[model samples]
Target: MVTLKQIAEELGISITTVSKALKEYPDVSKKTRKLVRETASMLNYKPNSFAVNLRTRESKTIGLIIPVIVHHFFSSVIKGIIEQAEKKGYLVIILQSNESYELEKKQVDLLLSKRVDGILISLANGTADFKHLNDVIENETPLVMFDKIAKMVKCSKVIIDDRKASYKATQHLIDIGCKRIAHFRGPLLPQNSIDRFLGYKKALLDNGLEYDSSLVYICECGDMSFEEGKLNAQKLLKEHKDVDGIFINTDLVAIGAMTEFMKQGVRIPEDISIVGFSNWFMASVISPSLTTINQPGLEMGINAFKLLYKEIKKKKKNSDFSFKELVLDTDLVIRESTKN
Candidate 1:
């Protein structure tokens, strides 16, 4: 129960120096680190792993890891997280995995080392291994997954049902007279992507449209970008010229596709009606407004933080961790990109 402040005072050093020394920060000399450790052991000081820094008992900090930082949806999510964390007097550390599993793992380790009170993450696109995620839980830190998440990882999560959302989007396309509908989906590893794909397939079956693998295109976007959308659209045009409707994974890609289609004299909602996921800001302002699914990034962020806060509080009180999965609702927005 020995605090870093007490150790610093006893060692006649600044609290910052004591903290840096304990963390072996490069700025802290080897002699200082050894002295701090020895003096701390002599004082029977034990660091609070849950609270992280003994400096102020709790670091009052949380780590947020996302796939893409610059994304409008993700940026909004960060805004929500920061606002909520600030209300509770907590600081947030934002890290972008750039959709790399390796980078995600390192970031997690860094957060742990820094002793953040909790962690909130949207799994990287390439994260197939759950060991890094498990390590946080195993270390008794409160961990919450949002948006892109893993099903096998036993922890709290907040997400909108991508499959159900995709189903509605596809059905809208079908309702609007899109017969030969094609899909541009995310990578196969993530659950949301898999769910969206299945939902697209199911909609086809239910509506009596034959499910064609040839019509489905996989995007390497991690989170589909504009260029990927355009490239895939070109392919979609060449390979499935008869396709009359398209359900895209994200708005940015959908825009990319729409741009490409326009270049070739394809009229929006005339030659091929289209639908997109995540009602991003640009979805509404484009040449022909994009029809999209409203994924509540801000609300998801607030709710995700609330969930993590609950678990963090529970851990601090010596209570056992109880996992909860909260699913938010998604709605389809009608736009000019699709048939009326």
Candidate 2:
């Protein structure tokens, strides 16, 4: 209930001077700024965010759209983004799309309506239509896509080279004398998943190995949980008894597969070799540490924030900006999962 007027009256200064001092405007003396801040803290005088946003045309907040927060990869990315955003005196609002296109669309609309200064999004799994994203672009809202992106949207993006990384992983399996490689792919719609699948197939074909259609399993069960991975691996093994190598879309899935393999009394790297994407923490901790592609999730998160910040600054300058697709290189991390 304590308005700027009350603070001004108590301080014996004009309301405009109090306002400027609270905002730390250089025009106000440092002594006035300190006194106003102390008084505001005592009074618990919180400025109306809507009014501040209206005046500056900036919410000083960034919206982060992620598929899921439970996964280690997304959690790490969020940590990196928040750390960087905090350094710049910005706040982040997180929204989970839950891997649904409809939910993602609704979240995007809500963020736009809230007038977020910028949006950093990793598209949902089944998001094929990008009209919602296009709406954000039309509104001239700075947008940066990371990980799973809308290919049609020409905007700033930060992602690892999934295709090349997958190729290296598969090639490593082949070099280790394992043929009949099976792929456990994620949803087909996300470009990153498609790219990783392509990389797996390319490695097979390039090495004069036949691409077996029977060996490809699509895990489109909404959640990429360890249970799903275990079930899918079991089904794949049932159908293809000769599957000697496995390329999973995620480290979690690979862990699940390893569990099932061990239960089945299968010798790892002896009877079968395994590779996974995203070098999550469990990958290194699990028995027979997983061989995976290090996606640089935290680095991608930092880069995404920087790109969004640049876009916001460009908008403030009233300058036209070109889209940037930043593809960070990936590394094939070798461990006990694969042999030779």
RMSD in order of candidates: 8.5, 2.3
Candidate lDDT (C-alpha), each: 0.92, 0.91
lDDT of 1 by residue, 63-141 (tens): 9999998898999999999999999989999999999999999999999998889999999999999999999999988
RMSD of 2: 2.3
Off by over 4 Å in 2: 11-17, 20-49
TM-score of 1: 0.84
Clashing pairs in 2: none
- Candidate 2 least-lDDT 10 residues: 220-229
